[model samples]
Target: MSVKNLLHSSKHSSKHSSKHSSKHSEDILVGVGLRHPHFTDILTSAKEIDFVEVHSENFFGQGGAALSVLQQVRETYPVSLHSTSMGLGSFADIPAHYLARLKRLTQTIDPFLMSEHACFTWGHLQGQLMHSGDLLPIAHTHNNLKRMCEQVDRVQTYLGRELIIENVSAYVQFDESYLSEAEFLTALCQQTGAKILLDINNIAVNSLNFEGGDIEKSVVDYINVLPIDSVAQIHLAGCSDVPHGQLVVDDHACPVSDDVWQGYRQALTRFGAVPTLVEWDSDLPAWSTLIGEAQKARDIANAVLGVNARASVMEINHE
Candidate 1:
């Protein structure tokens, strides 16, 4: 099917669209990292948050605290499985064992959706595993886009779910960079039958690190270029400020900044209330506090969607 035709079908299908549910979930779908600290509270309490996001690598192990708590939470709220280790856009093919494990986990958990960065993680030069601990930027040339589209297809097939590609936070740029990140992601989504997990925090961090980068422009660029229907979810997180200068790191350690919140409001306006998650990784507070933060995201979404908080809360609970 063509891109337009596929989007048409997806927009109409209950499985893909789920308009009522999606809108409702967007307001309440706040997520915290599946860390050891919040496991007990998450498993025991009736979570007010709409969903939870887990790092795929944490569950690459078996029968551990992470997996155990994840399984328990998967039984209740919706889940969005974000990955740091898929290495989807890399020079290497999918890791067989890792893919197998992820496949098994998805079969069991059945997340609302899954996503990974639009950067390379693993590469082999001289027969050695030269891995970057961070999500390294990719050159958005035609050849690279071809490779990326193919890799996205492979991931979707292997996982048996649509893979959402997220923009990465980077302080450096490649001299050979041929395409803007938004344009690259747009073409990749058009080529592959994938969705987007828009990370507002990353955009803010990237704009802050490099000169001449603006969060508003990045958000607007994405809104203008990518298919609004292709957005499966949105992510909000806190970032750490770089020392010396005003460079900001994409560290999910602190609270969400007011500037990042403005970026999110822009996204809410563009995406029309896509599911948003609060991604707190380090220095997590009590479960209630996290829920409160998530509630703020919902409020922002609701306001952007032109709905009141009471009605928004009702819609989420009903969905």
Candidate 2:
């Protein structure tokens, strides 16, 4: 069916738009990144998975096989739309065409949740629009924070739902950054009502790369500083293991590491079973293996939060 027809049918369906729910139990909520390589596996054999997440941009096409498959997936599981291209911190305006397409996709899918990074991507160069095509870190100054708040307010108002913004790992801290990252995030939440998608792996990677003290302590400290109620979701991902003083990247390319798992537990202790995702995008694993990682997240969260015997699954894929 065409995108318009599909959306028309969905809009008048039994379930409402802008907020989709799962047929599965939410008590043990967990999900995995739904990648094309494992589409059939997810539909056929994946059980205990509360929902599935996808890069919102992937299904933005008006009418195509991808969109059709996504519509099919929507039938079985709740879909979370994770968009990397929103560039919420950019100096230039968010492109009108991009926002309109995203709006349409949200209407079609009615994702249970939607998210983007705390970084910037597109800005004006001379007179034309240019995109860096990267989730580059944003400076943590109050001036920048004001701009980000405005951009976030604009996006949320345009989409008609609250947007979840994530904290990105940075190799270098801007010298002009007078405000702390947590402070800026808190301000954004306070001003725009947008929640945070806290990635524990990013916090760990940033601490390892720049925070220069105890790794676990610094990671946990950053989490503790953020407003507990501001976190709407959590992300658990693997990072490359590096020697002391070596650079660490949020590669999301392998099994989630020990440090990240530890931070994940700490997050649950604070955030209380916030819906989490397992992100392993680069070194994609078999569907079962990826699901195993998600199960691990469920198990750890269950143990930490005193949730018992509830079936849960975690997933991998970010960006």
Predicted structure with the largest lDDT when compared to the true one:
2
lDDT of 2 by residue, 1-319 (tens): 0112112223322232211122122344688988888878876894768778899988889999888888998898888899999899898888999999999999899887789999999987798898877788989988898889888877877777777789999877789988778888888887887788899888888887888736678766677777766787788888767787689877888898888888887766665657889887887999988889989998887686664212211210010
Q: lDDT values of the candidates?
A: 0.73, 0.77
Which residues of candidate 1, in runs, are more than 4 Å off?
A: 1-16, 20-28, 244-246, 307-319
For candidate 1, list the clashing residue pairs, or say none: 26-275
Instruction: Report each candidate's C-alpha RMSD, comma-separated, in the order given.
Output: 5.5, 7.3
Cα lDDT, model 1, residue 227: 59
TM-score against truth, every candidate: 0.86, 0.86
**Candidate 2 pairs with clashing backbones:** 31-315, 32-315, 278-316, 279-317, 280-317, 294-314
Clashes in candidate 1: how many? 1
